[model samples]
Target: MASSNFNRWLRPEVYPLFAATGVAVGICGMQLIRNITGNPEVRVTKENRAAGILENFAEGEKYRENPVRKFVRGKSSEIMPNINNFFSKPEL
Candidate 1:
């Protein structure tokens, strides 16, 4: 009985209202999650703006000098190199 009444109340004429309410609820839910996760919404500020620009310029310089080195560092490679050395062959 309750389900039938709910279906009757959700007529096609009220779809726009349902859609708007759904969008508002979704936006509020995302804001709640972002607050809980502590993610910064704004990246730029007066304190670090100049430092950020200088770092970007320095990175461009390094990229021009040695692209391969820059790629490795950018990927944060952490694999260790091999350590075994080969010995000289004995006379036959």
Candidate 2:
């Protein structure tokens, strides 16, 4: 019974329908996330810009930031000084 059920779902005839549904869901999810992240109405950057009706926090700040930017903004003193020295050219 279980094997029959599995075979019913795994039938080759349903591959195109499954593929289409998966792609549509994937696209919708991606667009939703993209709109959430990239929407300027929810972002606040300038002092004069009016705040969004639903915005309650620093959306722009979070949107513009990532791990690499956070690492670079930190005091170099907190990181290994030797790593900086390796990249910085010495003056003649």
Candidate 3:
């Protein structure tokens, strides 16, 4: 009867917190692995650095424009078509 009570405490409904804690630990482990393997300064060429900065700036501009486009014109459907097309495409 004591063992049965212990098993019942381990049931999913009673132990979601444990599962969530495990997931958080796993994510931290992966991040630690990434940090260990990642390079701090490989020294990108000036041209490549400029290109990367420009690309990131463009992405930021696009992200900032998204809400303005949606609210100003209210045309969410325009975005959906492109997303649908991306998912529908077959790789060559």
Candidate 4:
């Protein structure tokens, strides 16, 4: 009985339909969650704003000039030579 049940589950026709239905259900569930959480509009709005030619340029420039950014930039410059050395070596 167990072997027959396993054989039925291993049938190609049955498994394909089952997998398709499962994928459809997962997609539908994701859409449902996005709708309930308002994530779709938030992502669309962020993309639209970013697509503007000069909308956030000043804000981004200010962020780059901040003190924390200066510290990170200094550290990155120091580390870059070591990183380049690692990547420039030939394989053993």
Assess each prediction's global lDDT (C-alpha) against the native.
0.60, 0.72, 0.63, 0.67
Better of 1 and 2 by lDDT: 2
- Residues 3-85 of candidate 1: C-alpha lDDT, one tens digit per residue: 99999879999899999999999999976774544323323556754454343556455435564565577553435323221
Model 3 lDDT vs. the true structure? Answer: 0.63
Per-model TM against the reference: 0.37, 0.44, 0.33, 0.34
Quote model 1's TM-score: 0.37
Ranking by TM-score: 2, 1, 4, 3
Candidate 3: where is the Cα deviation over 4 Å? 1-5, 39-92
**Residue-level error in angstroms, candidate 2, position 53:** 4.1
Q: Write the per-residue lDDT of candidate 3 for residues 1-92, one digit (tens) a residue.
A: 99999997888786888889999999999767644444222225666545542435554555456544768675555557777878898567
In candidate 2, which residue ranges exceed 4 Å CA deviation?
Answer: 43-92
* Residue-wise C-alpha lDDT for candidate 2, range 1-92, written one tens digit per residue: 99999999998999999999999999999868866667546444655255436553476566567556787785675366876786785656
Checking candidate 3 for backbone clashes, the offending pairs are none
Residue 32, model 2: Cα distance from true site in angstroms:
0.9
Model 4 lDDT tens row, 1-92: 99999997888879878999999999999768755454323334666657646545665565447565676774646447777877897568
- How far off is residue 77 in model 1, in Å? 46
lDDT of 2 at 32: 83
Report RMSD (Å) for each prediction in the order shown.
15.9, 11.5, 13.8, 11.6
